[model samples]
Target chain A: MNEEKKISGIQFASLAFISRIACAFTGIPNLRTNLPTSDRISVFLIGLLLSLLLALPVLLFIEKENNRGLQNREKPCPSGIGRIILIFYAAFFVGAGILAVSRLGVFASGILLQKNNLHLFTAILIIAGAFCAERGLEPTARVSVLLSAAVLGGLLFTGLCDVGKMKLENLSQPFAGNIPIIVREAFFEACMNVELPVLMLLAPQIKIKKKTHLLLWLPLCFVCISAAFAVAAAVAGHYADLQVFPLHSLAVIAKTALFERIDDLLASLWVSCTVLKTGILLYTAYVAARTAVPACKKRCFFILTGALVFGGYLLLTANIQFFANVLQSAAVPVLFLFATVFIPLFTCLKNGRKEHKEVAKQ
Target chain B: MKILAIFLCFLLTFTGCSATVGTQLSNRLIIEAIGIDAQEDGFLVSVLALHTQQSNAANATETQDSIGQVFSAKGKSLSEAFAQIDLVSGLVPLYSQTRVLIFGKEIAENEPMQALDFFIRNYTLRESILLAVADAKASEIIETELEKNTLVSKNVQDILESGKNNGLTVAVELYQFVNRFLDETDAAYLPVIKTQENQSGKKEITHAGIALFAQKNLTAVIDKDAAKGLLWTAGLIDNDLLSIPFKGRTLSVAVKDCKSKIRLHKGDIPTFSAEIQFSCDLIEYNTDDTLLFNLQELEDVNRELQKQVQKITEEFIRTAIRENGCDCLSLLKKLRNGQPAYYAQIKDKQTDYLKDAVITVQISSEILKTGREVVKPN
Candidate 1:
C-alpha cells in the first residue's frame, strides 16, 4: 500500500514544523493575561526558547545512540526496561494525539458545529489519521508539506487583512503588570508545544545532516509560532484577552474588501493541519509499537496501534475535565522525564558511559 | 486485530450518524441591525430582521434591499432577551449581517460596556459594525422608516460615514470604540442621533455632534465644532468647510487637506502644543471690499482666518479638558510614547496630569486658490 522510499529533507522539515507549531498557532496560553500585550508575547517567545533548549539535548542523545534507522531499538530483555521505554513512547504518542484531537474538537464546536457534531468529526479524523499512518512516513510527510503550505497561506492571508486594523503601538509597552504570572505562563506555554518529545522519539528516522535540518525546522517553528502570537496580540489587542482561541477570533474579525469573515476558511485549513499532525503522531506511535515488539509485522503493528489509539480517544475523552486535569498535572514532569532522564540514561546504556564523555567534549 | 481494524473502518464509513445539521437559509431570519435600550425592569433588545415570505413577488423583483421591521423583547440579560426574540421570531435570528448597533441614552450612559460585551462575545457580530448613541429611545430610532425602503440601520451607517466626511462627527467603529474605551482614561466618544418629525409627518433622524463618555457615564454632548476639533486630533478630517468674516462680508473656504502634529516641550512641567496646518480654496467672497480682488488682501484675510480657527479649536480643547475632564488630545499617550522616562516620574499622579498640563494650539492655513477674482492688499 506504500512505497519504502526515504522522504526528502524538506519534507521532514515540513512535517516537523507542522506538528510543532500547529497548536501554538491557536494561541499562547491566556493564564497571565494581565501582562501587557508586549510582555505576553515576549514571555511566550521566551518559553518557546526554553522548550527548544530543553528538547535539544534529548534530540542529540537519540541521534548519537541510534545513527541508523528509527525502527531499531533492542531485543526484549529479561529485565524489560527497553520494553518499558518503548511502551512509554507509544503511550506518550497516543496521549498527545488524544489531546490534540480534543483541542480540535473545542475549536470546531465553538466555531461551526454543535458539541455532538464535533465528537463525530473527531472520530472521522482519528480513523482517517490511523489510515494515513498505516501507509508510511513518506505519504504522511508529503501530505504535511501540502497542509503546511495551506496553513501558512491561510494564516498569512488573515493576518494581512488585519494590518490596517492593528495598532503597532500596542506592542511598544513593557512588562508592567505581573512578572511572576508572566513567567509561569511562559513555561506553561512551553509545555504545550509537543515537538520536544516527539522529535526525541523520531530522531533515528531523520536522515539529512541531523544538525543542519533540525536547526532549520526547529527555529522556523519557533519564530512562526512567536510571530503568530505577536500578530494576534497586535491585531486583536484587549479583545483577545478572554477569547479561548485568540488567533481564530482574530481571523473571525479580519475582513478583506471581497469577504466579510475569513475565519471559516481559517478553521477549515487548521482542521486539515491538525489532522495531518495527528497522522504524523500516529506514525510515530506505530514506530514505537514496532520498536517494542520485534515479532510484530508492519501490518500487525499498524492495526494494534490504530486500535489502541481509537480506544484511547473514546475512553479518555468521555470526561474532558478529567482529561484536562490529568494532562495539566502530567505536563511538566512527563516532559522533563523524557527530555532529561530517559534520553541520557538510555543513551549511556546503549553506548556505555564513555559515550557521555565524548558527548561532553563535543 | 485486523478484523477489529476492518470492523472499525466499516463502522466509520458505513454506520454514518449525521453529527449535526447545518443552519439552512430558509430556517434563519437574517438580522440587518440590532438596538439596545434600558428599561425599568431590565433591558429591551430590538432587531431589524428580514421577512422571509414574499407578499407580492412582482413588486419585490426590483428591490435588492431586504424589507425589515424592528422586533423587540425585554429580559434581565442579553441572552435571555435574545431567547425571547427567538421565541417570537419563528425563524432563528442570525446576526452576521448586522450593520449598526444603536444604544439608547439610558443604556449608553448606564451600561455601555456591559451591553457591548454581549455583541463582542457573540461570534456572529463583526468588529466593524457602526456604533452610535441614540439621543432618544433606541427602539424608536430603529422602528422609524425612511424613503427608498432603506433600513434604519443602513441609514444610520450612512449618516455616520457622511457626517465623518463633513467633519460633523468622529468616525468610531466597534474596534476603535473598544480601543479608545480601554485607554488609560475612559474618554471614548460616539456619534449621537436624535429623531425629528419632518413636515410630511415622516420621522427623520439626525446625527447631532458626539456624545462623550467618562467610563460608562455619558458626561457631555459636544457640538459639531468641538467634535471636529476632537476628530482632527484623533481621526481624519475630510471636506470640512470654513467661513471667515472679511471686510463687511464672509469669505467661505473649502478645506482641501489638513495635517496636525503634536510636539511635546518638556519643562519644569511638560507643555504640549498641537500645530495644525490646513489647505483651503476660497469658494465664495461675499464682501465687495475692492481690496479683496488683490492677492495680497486675500493673504491678509487668510492670516486673520487662521487666528480665528486657532482660537476656536483651542477654546474647544480647553472646554473638553476642563469641563468634561476628557483627554480629547491623548496627551498622556503622547507623553508616554515620546518621553517614557519623564512619564514614569509622573505616573503616580497621572489622573491629575491632564488638569494641570498646559496645552497650546496653533493653526496655519494656506490659500490654495484665490478664485478668478484675485485679491491684492494695499
Candidate 2:
C-alpha cells in the first residue's frame, strides 16, 4: 500500500467506533449476563477497560512495526508460521463479518420488514459492502468518518428529545446485581468488542501521529455505547427488558414536535453503519488472505473474501436456529480473544526474543 | 460503466423492484384508536379507522361518521381479532398512526396482558400512544359519536391530555404502563375514560379517574382526589385547582408550580417521606371581609391552604398504599434505589411490604397573588 492509501488515526477510530455501534444496535447476544439495566454503563466501562488492557500487546506490536511500512515488514516467525497466523486471522475476520451481516439480516426482518426472510436485503447489503471493500481501506475509512458523524448526531438528537422522559427513579443502584454476575456480564461485554481485532489487523494501514491518538478510540467508543444504554434504560425503564432491540424501541417512542416515528430513519442509519462495518471487516479479511497467499492478485482475494462472507451470511440466516445457538455459545468470545490478544501477544514475544538474541550476539 | 452499474443497483435496491403494486394510502385503513374487550370464548377488538373515501372536508360535514368509521371483530386471540378487521374492512390496517389504545373494563380486570401483548409486540405501534381504560365496553367508547366533524379517538386523546395538564388524571402512555406492569414492586395505572351526555344531549368522553393494576389484574379504581394525591407525590401536578374552606368562606387557588421529593428511610420496614413544595395564586374567594387585605390574614389563608394540601396528600398515600396495597406511588422503586438490600429482602412480599410500609407526606404552599380585585365590594 502506498503512503496516500493509508488512513489517518482519526479515520481509523471512526471506523472502530461505527463498528462497535453497529454491534450494539444489532443487540449484544449475551443472554447469560443478567446485569441490571442501570448497571450497564458501569459494566460496559469495565468491559472497555478490559478490552484496552487486551489491546496492549497489539499496541506494542504496532509501535515496534511502525518504522516498517506495510509492504516492507518482515515476518516475526518463519514463513509457514506466518502463513498459518494469517490464515487464522482471515478465518476470524470472515466469521466476524458473517456474524455482522447475519445480525443485520435479523434486525431487518425483526424490526423493519416484520417478515421472516430478508434474503434479498441481506444480499444487497453484502454486495454494497463488498463493493466498498474493493475500494480499499482509505475510502472505507473516509466514509466511516462521515457515517460516524451522522450516527453521533442522530444519537444526540434522540437523547435530547428523550431527556424530559428520563426519570431518575427508573435507574437502579450500580452494581446492585451479584458481584460475580456483574463481573461475568462485564466479561461478556468485553468479548463483544471484536473491533479490537479489526484494529490490530488495520493498524498497519493507519498512520498514527501520536500514541495518544490510538488511546482515544476505546474510551470514546465505550462512552457512546454506555451512554446509549443508560439513556435507553432511563427512558424505557423496565420496559426495555421486554424489547429485543431497546434502542430501536427507544427511537420509536422518541417523538418531538417536528419528527414523529424517527425510528425508521434511525434504523436506516444503523443499517448503513452495519454495511460499513461489514465492508471494513471484508477488507481486513482480504488483506489477511493476500498476505497468506502472495501469489493471488489483490482484487481476486478481495472478491474471494467477499464471496465467502456472503456465503456464510446466507448459511447462517438459512439456519437461524443454529445461528442463535452459535451466538449463545462461547465460541465467539473465544475466537475474539484468540485473534485479538493471543496472536498479537505471540508475535510481540517472538519479536522481542529475536531482538534480544541480536543484542546478546553484539 | 461501473458508475452506471452502481446507479442501477442503487435504483433497484431503493425502489424494491417488485412486480406487485404497493398499497396506496387511500386503500389503507389508518387505525387511529383500538379497543379491546374480553368475551366468554375469545376477545373482541374494535378499531376507529379513517375512512379514506369519506376523508374530504365536504364529506366530513355531511355526517360525523365520515370523519372515522368503527369496525369490530372477534377471535380467539388479539392477532386473530385484528387480522379479521382487514377482512371486514377490505383494506390494509395501518397502526403507525394509532393515537390511543383503550381496554374494556372486563379485559382490564380479567387479563390485560392478553390485549396488551398484541400492542406491545406489534412493531408498528408507537410506544408513546396513550393508554386508557374504558368504564364500560371498549367498543361503546370507540363507536360513540361526538360533535359533528370530530374524531372520538382524537377527543379521547385530548381529554386524557387535558386531564393530565389539569392534574385531574395521569395520562399513562403505552411504555409507562408496560414499564410499571413489568416491575414487580410498582403497580400500573391508566387514565379511565367514560362517555357522558352533556346538557345539550351530546355524548362526550370524559376522564373518570385512574385504574390501578396489581400485577396483571385491575385491583382498584382511585377517585379524582386520590389521583390528585398520586400526581402530587409523583411531581406530575400542574395548574390544578384547589379549594379550601377558611373560616366559613371558600377560597379557590390554582397551583402555579409544584415540586416533590420522596426519600426512603430504611428500618425493619422501609418508610417513605414525600416533601412537596407548591406555590398557588388565588383564583377566587367568597369572603367579603376587608381583613383579607391585611398581610396577616393572607398568611392565615396560606397556612390553611397548606393544611388542606397536607390532608389531601396524606389521604391519597394511605388509600393507595395501606388500604388498597397499590404501589402506584413507586415506593418500592424508591426503596430499591435508596435501600437495595431491604428491597431485595421484601421484593417477593411486595403486597405485604406495601401494606406494612409507612408513608409520611409534608406539604408547604405559598399563595403568590390574589385575584384581580384587591378589595372586596362593600
Candidate 3:
C-alpha cells in the first residue's frame, strides 16, 4: 500500500469499533436460542471473551508477518490456491456487507419509517456505501474516527436521560438461564462481530506504533456492548422482550428537560454507523476481488462487488422467514471461524514451514 | 461529469421513492388523548384530537371549547374503530402526540390487556404515555367540557401529576403497567380519574384514587389514603402534606425527601419488611400556641406524624394484600430480586405465598425545618 493509503492504528480500531457497535444498536437479533434481556450482559461479556480467543490466530499472523496484509501474503502461496483463497475472502466480505445493509433496511422499515419503501431506502444506502468505498480506505477510516465520537456522545446523552428510570429489580442473576443455551447464544453473538475478519484483512494498511492499541479494542468493545444491553434491560424491563429493537424503544422514551424525543436524531446517527460499516466491507471486498483476478480493471471489480452485495441483500430479505432462520443458523459462525481463524493459522504454519525448508537448502 | 451523474441519480431515487408527505398539519387529526370503553358487542373508542383547522383567533374567542374535538367510533377492535374515525373525520389520526390513555371501569375490570394491546403494539404510540382508569365511562371524562381554554386531556394529565407529586396517587405509565402485568407475581395499578362538578357547577376531572389489578383483573379501587400508603411503600412519594391531630388542633407538616427499602427474609413462608425514612417541614397549624417552637413539642409532633403514617401504610398493606389478595406492594418482585432461589421454589404458587406472607412496616420522620416562624406568634 502507498503511504497515502496507510491509516493509523487508532483509525483502524475506530473502524472496527464502529462496525461492531452498529449491530449492537440494533439489539441482538433473532437467534435459535432466545436469551432473556436480563441475561444479555453476561452473554455479551462471554461472547467478547470468545471473540478475543478466536482473534488470536489473526493477531499471531500480524505478529509473524511483519505488517504484510492477508491479501499481500496471498501472492507468496501456491498459485491456484492463492487465487482461490482470495476469491473466498472476497465472497465473505460481500456476504458480510449484504447482512449489514439488509439489517439496516429492516430496522429502517420496521422502526423508523414504517410507511416508507424498504427497497428504495436500502438501495440508496447501498449506493452511498459504494460511493464511500470507492473513495478508498484512508478516507473511510478518517471518517470513522469522527463517527465514533458522535456515537459515544449520543449514547452518553441518552443514558444520562434514562438514568433515573433504571431499576435494580429489572436485572437478574447472570447465568440464571440454561447453561447450554447461554453458551450457544454467546457463540452466535461473537460470530456477528465480523469486524474481526475485517481487521485481519486490513492489518497491513494500519501503521502501528504499538500493538497495545490493537489489543485494547476487544475490552473496549465489550464494555460498550455490555453496558448498552444492561441499560436496555434495566430501563425497559420485560417490555424489552416485546420490542423488535429494545434500544430503539429506549430511545423513543428517553427524554430530557430540553428535548422531548430524540429517537429520530439518534436513529440517524446509528444508520450512519451502519453505512460506514457497509462501506468498509465493500472496500475490503473490492481489494480481495482485485487480488483474485489481477487482470480485471479496478473500477470493474468495485462496481461488480457493489452490484453483487446489493443482489445478495435482495435475495436474503426476499423471504423474511428464511432470512430469520439463516440468522439463527450455525452457518455464520462456521464461516466466521474459517475466514478469521482457520485461514490465518494455516497460512502462518505454511509460511513457517517454507522458511525452515529454505534455510536447510541454503 | 461524474458528480453531476451522481447528483442526478440521487435526485431521481429520492424524488421517485420518497415517503408520502402530502398530509398537512390540517389534514392530520393530532390525537391528544384516547378513551376506550367496553361495549356489548365491541368497544366505544373516543379520541380527543386537536382541531388544527381552527384559526388562532377563532380558537382564542372560543376558548370555552373547540380547542380539541372528540370523535367516537365503535367496532370489535381498536384498529377497526380507528378506521371508522378516519372515515368520519376524513383525516388521518396521528397518535405520536397522545398524552394519556384512559380505560373505562368495565374494560379495566374485565379485559384491560385486551383494550391496551393495540396501544402497546403500536409503533407510533409512546410507551411513557400516562395511563389511567375512569371512575365510570371513559368517554364521559374525555367528553367533559371545561371552561377557560382547558383541554380535557391536559386537565386529566395535570390532575394525575399533581396527585402523584402530593403522594395521593401513584402515576403509572404504559411501560410500567405492562411490566407489572407481565410479571405474574406483581400487580399493576393506574391512577383513577373521575368527573365531578366543581363548586362553580362546572364539570372537572379529579384524581379519585387508584385502581389495583391482580394480574389481568381489576381487583380493587384503593382510596386516596391507601394510595398514599402504596406510594410510601413503593418510594414513589416526593412531597405530601401530613395533618396530625395534636393537643386539640391540626398540625400540618410538608413531607419531602421520602425513601423506602423493602427487605425479604426467606423461611417456610417469606417475611417482608419495608423501612421508610422521610423529612418534613412544619408548614401550618390550626392553633396559635407559642410553645410550638419548643424542642419537646417538635419531638411530640414528629412522633405523632410517624404514628399516623405507619397506621395508614399498614392499613393499606392489609386491605390490599390480605383482604383483596393484591400484590400491589410488589413483595413478590422483592422476593425475586432479594432471594431468587426462594422465589423459584414458590414461583408456581406466588399468589398463595403472597397471601400467607408476613409484612412489617417501619416509618421514621425527622422535622428538618419549622419554616419562617421560628419564634411563633407573640
Candidate 4:
C-alpha cells in the first residue's frame, strides 16, 4: 500500500461532486433547450437538485472505504462484485463526458460566437481531452482543481458585474410547472451526477481519514448547485427560461468594465473543464479494463482514447436535432436511472451486507 | 515493430491534416444594417457591407474602407432578394454583425412578419437586435451616413442610445416585438424614425410617431399627444412636465419614477381597475395671490393632481384602444395569464373582451418639497 497517498476522503467526494454538478449545466440544457419564459427557474432548480442526488452515493461509498478493509485492494485479483461496480462507473462517467462536451460546443457556438462551427471545435476539444486522459488520474485531478477555480471565479465576476439587472420580483413567483416532471427529472439527474465515485475504485488504493469526506462533499455539492441557480436568476430574470443556456447568456449580459465580454472567458473555462472531465473518465475506463484483464493495460489506453476520439468526432459532426431527439426520448432516462438508482441499490445491498456480516463477527 | 510503425503512421496522418486545414476569411459579406421595403415586385432588400480590408483596425474607424458597399435586390422572398445582392456585390452575405432592422411604413402596414422570418430562423442572428419602422423608404435612412460616424449603417442604434424621452417613439427590441406577436391579446408598437438632411454636414434622425400592429399588421399610428398619455398610463413617464391645478393656483410638477398595476373585474360591466403610483417634487409655482399653508389645502392639491393624472390616462387608453381597437396595454394578455377562466369565457367574442375592460386609477404621491419657500405676508 502507498501510505504516502495524500488524497483525503473529502477530496474524493469533491472530485465526484464537482464532476457531476458540471453535468447539471450539460444534461439540463438538452431537456429544455428552448424553454419558454415562465419555466426558467423551475428548470434551473430541477437541474441543480437532480445533479446533487445523482452525486451523493459515490460520496457515501468513498466515505465507508476504510472501515470495510477496501483500501489497498487494487493490486490483487479484484472481486466479481467490485469489477461490476467499476464497469458501471466507467459507463456513467464516459456518458457524462460525451454529453458535457456536446453541450459546451452547442452553447459556445450558439451564444458566444453566434456561429455554426460545432463540428470543428467539439472534435478539437474531445481529442485534447482524450490525450490528457492517457496521462494519468493525479494530473487529471490537478486539472479538475484548476478548472473548478476558474468556473467559480467566472460565476462570481459575472454576478458582481450584473448587480443592477437582476430583479427579485421576477423570481418572487413560485415555480410553476408540472410537479411530476420536475420531481422525476430531479431524481433521475441525481443518478447522473453521483456516479463519479465509482471511478475512485480503480485508484481506491489511495486511502484517506474516514467520515470527514461526507461532510466536505455535501456542502460543496450544495454550494455549486445553488450558485448555478442564483446566477441563472440574476442574469436572465424573467427571460431565463426562454434562453438555451442561461449561464452562457448571463456571461454575455455581464458587460463589465475593462472587458468587452466575459462570455469568451466562460467558454475557455468550459473547454478546460470539459477536458479535465473527459480525461478523468477515459483514465477510469483504462483502469477498469486493466483491473478486469491485467495483461492489456498499455495497449488499452491507446485503444480507449482512439475509440472515444472517433466517437466524439461522429457525435459532434452529426446533425444536432438527431442527437437532441435521441437524448429526450428514452436513452437519457434509461442510462441515468441505471447508473444513479439501480447500480447504487445493487452495490449498497452487496457491499452493505458484507460490512454487516463482518461487523457481526466482531 | 510492424504494428508500431503502422500506429505511428496513423497518428501522424490524423494530426497532419488537422493543422493544415485553416479557416479562410469566408467570402461571406457581413451585413451591418438591413432595410426591408415593400416594392412593386415583392420586397426590396438593401444591405450595408464594409468594404474588404486586410487590417482589423479598419473596422473600428469610419474610413475602414473607401466606402461601405451598398447592395440592393428585389424578389418575392427576403432570402431570395438577399441572394441576388450576392450576385451584384460578389460577396457571400453574412448576418452575424447585423445590428438594426428597418421596416418601411408600407411593409409595416401590410405585413411585418413576412420580412421577419429570415432573421428568426438564422442561428447567427441575435434576438436582441433592435427593430425600427421608417416614415418613408427604409433604404433612404440606411444610406444616410453621419459625417463623423460614416460607417453608421444602423441609424436606430444611435437613436435608442441618445434620444430624449418622446411620447411618439416607443423603442422595442426584436424579442419584445416577437413576444407581442406570440401573445394573442397583445398588439405590437414599434418606434418610427424619419431622416432629415442637416446643413452642418452632420446626418440627423428624428423619432416620428409609433406604428401600431395588430394581428401582425399595422392598425393605426398614435400621434405624439396620445403617445405621451399612453406612456403615462404604461408608467414609463420620465422627466415630464405636468401642470397641476392646486386650489386657485397652478404648480409645475416634475414627475419621476412612475409605476402602475391593472386588475380586471368580471360581471355585467367588465371593469378594469388601474392603480398608478408616482413620485414628484414641486418644480415651480406661479400665481398672483399669496397662499396660506394648511393641511386641508395640501390634501386638496394632492386630490386635484390625482384627478388630472387619471383623466389623462383614461383619454389615452380611449384613443389607443377604444377608438383604434388595438390593445397595446395587453388587457387581453393580463386576463389570460392572471385569470385563465375569464380569458376562456371571453375568448370567442372580441366585444366581450374589449367592451368590458375598464380603467380605474389609484395614486399615492408624496410632495418632497413645495418649491423653495412659502410666501410670507409682505
Candidate 5:
C-alpha cells in the first residue's frame, strides 16, 4: 500500500563528482607547496582511484538489494542493509568532521580572525552546524546545496579579482619538484579531496532519477578540480617551490583600492567551507551507523558524542604544528586505505553472495 | 534544574568577559623605531614609543607639535628585553607599524644572523619593516635631530625611497633580508646610516654605504663607488650619471630605462656572462652646443658610455664573487632554483668555485632624448 522511493544512476554520479570536487579544492593547495609537487598530484589520483574501487561494490550491491526486493514480492525484505550503511556513514562522518573542523579551524584562525578571537568564532560556527544537523538530512542537504553554490561563487570572484597578479611564466615548468616529493605531496593532497566520495554512504537515500543528473554532476567535478589546480599553479609558479602556502602567498599579491588585504577574505571562505563540509560528514557518520545497526539510535549518539568529540578535538589540537604533521603524514594514508580498500572489499563479498542467491532462486 | 544552572553559569562567564575598551591595549603603543645593538653578554634593545599628553589650550601655542618617548633596555633575549621595556612604558609597545630596525655596526658585523633570527621569529613583526645598519651607534642615529624633525619616520622613509631615484643606496626589507639569508646561493645587503655633527650644533643622519653579508653574516662593507657598481649589476640604477670625455669635453648623461642579466656557463672553470642594456638622456654638456645632435653623434656617445658602465659592473661582479666571496646579485639562487643538479655539486665549494668562474659584461644603450638644445650663445 506504500511506495518506496529509489535513487537513480544520475544521482549516484552526482554524489561521486560533487564529493570529489569539494574535498580536492580544500587540500590541493596545502599539498602542492609543502611537499614535492609530483607526489601531491600522484597521491591524489591514487587515493581517488582507490576511493572509486571501494565505492563500486557498495554501489552495485545497493542496486542488487533494490532488484532483489522487487523480484521476491512475497518474502519480507531483509532489514539489515540500512544498519550496515549507517555504520559506514558513522565512521566516515565523525572521522571527517573531527579532521576538517580541527584542522581548518586552526588555519582559519591564523588567516582570518585575530588570534584571541579565532577559537571563539570557529566554535560558534561549529555549534551552529551541529544544531542544524539535528533537524535531519533533508535540511542538511538543502543547506549544503546553497552553501556549495556560495563557495563556488566566492572562489570564482576571488580568482577573478586576483587574476591580474597571476604570472603565466611561473607555471612554465610542470612537476618541477623532485619525483619522490611529488608522489608524497600528491598523497597528502589526495587525502583532502578523495574523502569526498565518502558521501556515497548516503547513496541509498537520494532520489536521483532524472536524466539530467549526470550532465550536472560530471562537469561540476571537473570545474572544481580545474579551478583549484589553476589557483595553486598560478599563485605558486617558480617561487611556489620556496613557500609553504603558495595560494595564500598569491592572495597576498592581490591589491585593490577597496582592500589592501584579500588573504583575509580567502581565509574566511575556507572557514565557511570547512564548517559545511564537517556538518555533512558528521551527519553521514550518523546515518551510516544507524543503517548498519537497527538497535542503535544514531541521532542520539551524535548528541551524546558531540561534547566528547569536541573535547577530544581540543586536547588533540593543543599543538597546531604537531596536528598538521599528523594529518599530512599519518591520517591521509589511513583515509586512503579505508576509502579505496576496505569499502570495495566488503562490496565484492556482498555482491558475490547476492549473485549466488539469484542463481539459486532461478 | 542542574542543566539550567550550568547554562546560566556559561552565560555569566561569557558576559563577564566582554570588554569595553574601544581599542586594544596593544594598539595603543606606537613603536616608531627599533634599535638592536650587541652587548658584551647578548643584545641591547632600544625602542622609541609614542608618549601622549593632554595640553591646555591656554598653554598650547600656534606651533604645538607631537612629541614621543624613547625607551631602552638590555636582556639576554629579545622577548625578555621587550618585557623589560614594557614595564617602564605606560602603554604596551606595538610593532605593527614599526618603520625601521637599525642594527649597530658591531652587532651587524659580529652576529648579524642572530639579530635577523629575532625579527623573523616574532609573529607581530612584519616583513616590510625597513632593515638598516647604523654607521656609528643605533641610539645615536635615532637620537640625531634634523631640520624640521617633525616627522622623523617620514624623513627616513623619504630618504630610503629617494635611494630609488638614484643608485647611491640599497633598500632592503625584513622579508627580503630573511629570504636572501635562507637562500643558500644568495647574499643580503642593508643600507648603512650614520649620525654626524654638521657645521652647526645639530646632529644629522648620513647614508654611508651598503653593508654586504655572506650567508647572513656580515663579511665586508661596500663603499659608495662599490654600491654604485653593485646597483649597476642589479639593474637598479635610474639616474646614474655617466661622465665620458668626447671631443676633449666632458658630457654627463643620466641613465633611464635599464635591464641586467647574468647567464652562467660551466666547463673546466665556471663562467658567467653579464648583459646590461639601458637608455640615457643627456643632462649636461661642457661645450655650448646650440643645435640638436644626429643619431650618429648620439650612437657614438652611447657606445662610449656602454663601455664605461660595462667595465665597472663587470669589475664589480668579478671582485664581489672572486675576492669577497659575496653572492649579492642573487645569481646563485636563480641557478639553484633553475638548475638543481648544478647547485648540488657546487654548493659546498661555492666560494672556490666562484673564484674560478669567468665573468663577462656586455652593455647595449639607446639614447631616448638629449637636453634642450641651447642655441649657440652668439
Candidate 6:
C-alpha cells in the first residue's frame, strides 16, 4: 500500500513513552490519590512490575522476529494464523483509540471548555488524530517526539511549583489498608497503558536495537509519573481523593509569580498529546486492517480505520465510565493473553509447520 | 480562487474570540471580595466589584465615588444568590479576582456547609481565597467604605498577608481549610477580622485572633496571642517581637528567626514536646546598665528573653490543647508520620492522649545586634 519506512529505535521509543505518560495527566495508575505514603509507594511499585511483565514479551518478539512486528511480508502462515494475528491487532488498536478519546471526553466536560458537553473537543481530537493517521506511522512517531516534550513540560511545571504547599504528614500512613485492592488496581492499571501492545504490533517497521526502547523509557515514565503522584498527594492532602480530575485540580490550585490559571494552560498543551495518542492507536489498527483487502491501499485503510474509531467513540462517549470499567476488569487479561501468550504460541507453531514441510521436500 | 480564499480569511476574523476585549470589560464585573451571611430562610451574599469602565472614565470624582460598589442579594443557594446579583446589576459577576471570603459570625458559629458546597463545586473560583470570620454581620464589613484609594478586597488581602507574614495569625487559604476539614484530626483555624471604631468614629477592620473549627463546626475563638504560640511550636514565625524585664531594665528586640523542632514521645502514653531556638537583633532599648553595652549583658538579656517567651508560649499552648482541645500545632499529624505504631494506638483516643501527655517548651535565643550602648549612667 505504501513504501516501507524504517524508523530508529529512539523514535519508536518516544511514541511508546508519550502514550504511557499521557494517561497520567488525568490520573496516574496504581498510585491512589491522597493515599498514605507507604500505601501509595506500594501501589506504584506493583503497577511498575505488571507493566514490565507485559512489556517483556514484546521486546522478545521483536528480537526473535528480526525487527519485524506483524508486517513481515516474507513469511506466510499456514492454517490462516496470519489472518488471526491481523484481526486481533486491529481490534486491540481500535479499542485503545476509543479509550483515549472517551477518557479525554469525560475529563474535559465543563473543565477546559467550560461546557457541560465534551463533544466539541472530542470531535476535534478525533479529526486531528485521523489526519495524522492518514500520514502513516513514522510521521506519527516523529510528531510524538514533540508532543512528548510539551506533555512533560506542562506536568513538571505544575508539579515543581507546588512545593510550598506540600504537607508530608497528610500522606504519613506508611502501611497499606487493603492488599487485595492494591493488587487489583495495579493489574487494571497495567492494561490502561496500551503502548506495550501497540509496540509489539509495530516492531517490524522499526529498526530494532540490542537495548530496546523500554530500557530507558519505562523508568523515565515511572519516575516522572510517580513524582507527580507523590507531589499531588502531598500538596492536596486529604482533598486529593475528593477531586474528580486530580491533576487538573492540582493545576488549578498551583500558581507561579507570573502565571496563574495553569490548569487552562496545561489542558491546552494536552490537546497535542491527545492527538498523538489517538493517532498512534488508529495507525496501528490501519496496518493490520489493510491485510484483509487485497486491493485496499493504505489511504483507504486509514480512512476506514478512522471512520470506525470515530463511530465507536460517538456511541461510547455517553458512558465514559463504562469503558473505564471494561478496561480494568476485562481488557488487561485479554490483551495479555493475545500479546503475551497467543501470539508467541501461534508463531512457534507456524514456524515448526514450515520447517517440517521443507525437510520433507528435501 | 486566491481572491475567494482571501475573502474567507477576512470573514473569519470578523467574530473575534478575545476574552479581555475593551467592550466585554464593561459587561463583566470583577468581584474582589465576597461576604456571606445566614438568614432565616436564605443567605445574604454581598460582593465588592470593580466598576472598571466607570472608574476609567474621565471625570471630577470624589473620594467616595472611586468605582467600588457593594451589592447584596438573597437566595436559597450560592449559585442562585450570585445569579440574582447579575439580574439586578445586569453585569456578569466574575469571581476569578476574588481574594477574600468573609463569613458572618452567625454562619461561622452554626455551619458553613451550604456555602462551602457551592465554593468547592464552582470551577471559576480559585482555592487561594483567604477565609476570614467577620466580627459582626458580613455585610457590614463589605459595606463599610474604607478611607483608602483602593477596593476593600485589596485592603483585606494586604492586611491578611501582612499578619500572616508577621506571625500575627495563621495563613488559611480555602484549600488548606478544606484539607483540614477532611483530615483525620478534624481541626483547623481561620483568621478573624473585626471592625473597630476609631476615636473619630470611623469603623475599620483589624485582625482580632483566630476562630478554631472541628470538622466544619466552630469550637472556640482564641486571641492573636494564642495563635502566635501555635506558630512558635509549629516553626512558622516571621516578624515577631519580644519585650523582656531584665533586672529593672526593659529589653525589647526584634526577633530575626524562631524555629521549632517538635517530637512526639510514645510508650506508656504519647507525649508532645517542642524545642524552640530563636535569634534576635536589638532594635530599641531604654536601660541605664553599662553592662548592656558589653557582651555579658547581651548573653543575660538573651537568657531572660528566652524565659519570658517560654512562659508566654506555654500559656498559649495550654489554652489551645487543654482548654479548647484543639490540635492547633498538628501534633497528631506529627505522631502519625514520625511514630506510626504509636499513632495507630492513639488514633481513636487522640484527644485524651494529648490531654494526659506532657508538653515541654524549651527556648534558646541569641541577640545579634545590641545597638551601641553608648548611654552612660544618667
| Top of the candidates by lDDT | 3
In model 5, which runs have C-alpha deviations exceeding 4 angstroms?
Answer: A1-85, A108-118, A131-182, A202-259, A286-309, A320-332, B1-27, B51-67, B147-150, B197-201, B236-254, B266-270, B283-287, B334-345, B371-378
Report the C-alpha lDDT of model 3 over B208-309, residue by residue, as the tens digit. 888889868899999988888898888887788899998898889999888888877777667889899999999988787553567777888889999998
Best-fitting candidate, measured by DockQ?
Answer: 2
lDDT per residue (tens digit) for residues B98-120 in model 2: 99999999999986887788788
The sequence of per-residue lDDT tens digits that candidate 2 reaches over residues A196-230 is: 77766677667878755765778887888888888
Off by over 4 Å in 1: A1-4, A31-36, A73-79, A114-116, A210-212, A295-327, A330-333, A336-341, A344-350, A354-362, B1-21, B55-66, B236-268, B271-316, B334-351, B361-378
Model 2 stretches with alpha carbons more than 4 Å out: A1-3, A28-35, A67-72, A75-78, A115-117, A298-302, A356-362, B1-21, B56-65, B246-249, B267-269, B286-294, B344-353, B369-378
Model 4 chain A weakest lDDT span, ten residues long: A66-75
True contacts kept of each: 0.12, 0.39, 0.27, 0.03, 0.00, 0.27
lDDT of 4 by residue, B277-307 (tens): 7767667668766544455655666677777
Poorest 10 consecutive residues by lDDT, candidate 3 chain B: B11-20
Better of 3 and 5 by lDDT: 3
Chain B only: TM-score of model 4: 0.76
lDDT tens digits, residue span A1-362, model 5: 01124444443443344344445433325532464322243444544454444445435544545533211212333255534434554665676676666665554434333335545654665564465445455554555565566556756766776674443323324455566765565455445544334534454455655323423444455455545455545544433344444455445545366864555555545555555555556655554554454455755766654654576568646776666666656755675556545654565576678889999999
Per-prediction interface RMSD in Å: 6.5, 4.3, 5.1, 9.3, 8.7, 6.3
Which run of 10 residues does model 6 chain B get worst, by summed lDDT? B11-20
Could you give the candidate ranking by lDDT, starting with the highest?
3, 2, 6, 1, 4, 5
lDDT of 3 at A130: 76
